[model samples]
Target: MNKGQISNTLRQYRLLYPLDKLRYLVERNKNKKLNEKFKKDNPEISLPPDYLMYESFQIDYSKYYFGGKTTAEWIFKLLGKHINLSGGKILDWGCGPGRLIRHMPDISNDQSSFYGTDYNKESIQWCKNNIQKVTFNHNNLEAILPYEDNTFDAIYGISIFTHLSKEMHFNWFNELKRVLKTGGVILITTQGENFRPKLTGEERKKFDQGELIVKGNVKEGHRTYSAFHPDPFLKLVFEDVDILDKIVISPKNKGYLPQDRWILKKKALV
Candidate 1:
C-alpha cells in the first residue's frame, strides 16, 4: 500500500497515534541548531518553549516568531477595509502561542481589542506571561468560546479549521457565528483545491466529488489530524454566513500547497 493508504488504514484501526508520536520524535530535533541561532538573533521578543512552539505552530522558531508579524500584516491586508476604524474587537480563534496575536497591536491602525483563545493551556499560559496588550483564554475542544453572543467585531483562525474533524467544521462554525456581531467578518484558512496534490488517491477522488476529506485517528485538534475542504463542501459548511470573498493563498516557501482564505460576514437581523 502507498503511504496514504497505510496512514488511512492505521487510522481506521486506531493505530495512527503512535505513528504521529514517532513523527514528532523524528522532527523534534530537526531544527535544534536553528532554534538556538534564532534565540540569539532576536532577544527582544519572548518565545514559547520549543515543544510549545512546535505544538502550536511548527518546529521552526523563525517562522513562529517573524512569520507571525508577516501573517498579521497579510491578515490586515486581506481584511483592512473591514477593520473597525473606531477600535473594534478582534479575536484569533485557535490562536497558537500568540504567534499572530502578538503583532496585531502595533500593526493595525485602529485601537481594536485583540483576544486569543486556544485549547492548549500551555500555549495560553505562555501568551499570558509573555505577550502583552492582548487577552488570552483557554478553551476546551468542545465547540464553545468564552465570550458572549455577538461579542466580536472580527475573528480569524489560521489553519485552525484545516486540523478539525468534519463535525467540528459545522459545530465550531456555529459557535463562531454566534459570537460574531452582525456585519462583522471572520477569516479562516482551509486546505482547498490547491492542496489536492497532497491527497491520496481515495481522498482525491472523494474531495473531487465535493466531500470533506478527513484524516483522523490522531487527536482531533492536533496538527497531525487533517481535513481538506472542497469549495462546494466549504460553501455548505458556512452557508449560514455570507461569503464576502475567497482568496487562495500560495505557500510562502513552496514546500506546502496553497490554502484557501475565506472572508465571511454575519448578516443583519431579519
Candidate 2:
C-alpha cells in the first residue's frame, strides 16, 4: 500500500473501533428515532418496503462516519470524461437522493440527458422535488426498468455494487448493459485491496473486538458489502466490453475504505 492507502487503512481502523460500539447499539435499537423522523417529515409518504427500511436504518448511523461528496465528485469526473455526454442519455443507476447527480457538473453544455432511480420512495420523491432537470423513478430491481434497450449512452453505479450480492450484481450488470448503447461507457466503484479483509487469528480477534470490519460476503439483510478482486470480477461481468481504465483513489478525508473505479465501454461491432 502507498502512503495514502496506509493512512486511510489506519484511519479506518480508528474510526471503526468507536463505530463498532455505536453500530451495535444502532443495530440493537435499529434507529427507531430516525425512522420516526422519516415518517414525521414525509407524512404523505408510505413507509419504505421492509427490507429497504432495514437497510436505510442501518445506513443512517453509518453515514455519520463515512458520508460526503468526495465519492460523488470522483464518480462525476470519471463519467464526464469517458461518457460521450454530447447528445447522449445517462442513467444514474441506484441513485440515492440524487446526491451524485446533484453534485455532478452541469454538463448541459454537453447536451447530455440525466435520469435517476432508486428503491426508496422517500429518496425518489426528494430527488423529484429537488432536481427538476433529472427524471427520477421509484423502482425496485426485480421490476422492469422504464428505459428501452440501447437507450442510454452511458450508465453508472457508484458504490452500488459494493452493497449487493453476487446475484444482484449480475442482474444489474446485465440490465445496465441491455440499456446501454454500443460504445457506451459505465463506471462503478467498490472496496479494493487497500481495504483488506481480516484473515489471521489476530485480525479475527480484532474484528471481534471491533477494531476491524471485514467486507466480503453478506448473508442477510436487503444489502451487504460484497468485496471482489477487481480484475476477475469486472472481466467476468464485462466480458463483451472493454475495460478502459481501473484507477484507485485514496480516501480524501478519512473513515472510509479506499475505492477502485472501473471504466468500461460496450464493444462496438466491427
Q: State which candidate has the highest lDDT.
A: 1
- Stretches off by above 4 angstroms in model 2 are 1-73, 105-110, 198-225, 250-254
What does candidate 2's lDDT look like per residue over 138-170, in tens digits? Answer: 777563577888999888876677666556666
RMSD of each: 2.0, 8.9
Off by over 4 Å in 1: 1-3, 10-15, 250-254
lDDT of each: 0.86, 0.62
Error of 1 at 109 (Å): 5.1
How do the residues 1-270 of candidate 1 rate in per-residue lDDT, one tens digit apiece? 766777788889887777766766667678878878988888887988777777777878889878888989888777767656348888999988888999998887547788999999989988999999999999999998999999988999989998998889999999999999999999999988777766799789999999999888788898779898999999998887889899876677757776888999999978
Error of 2 at 81 (Å): 2.7
TM-score per candidate: 0.92, 0.65
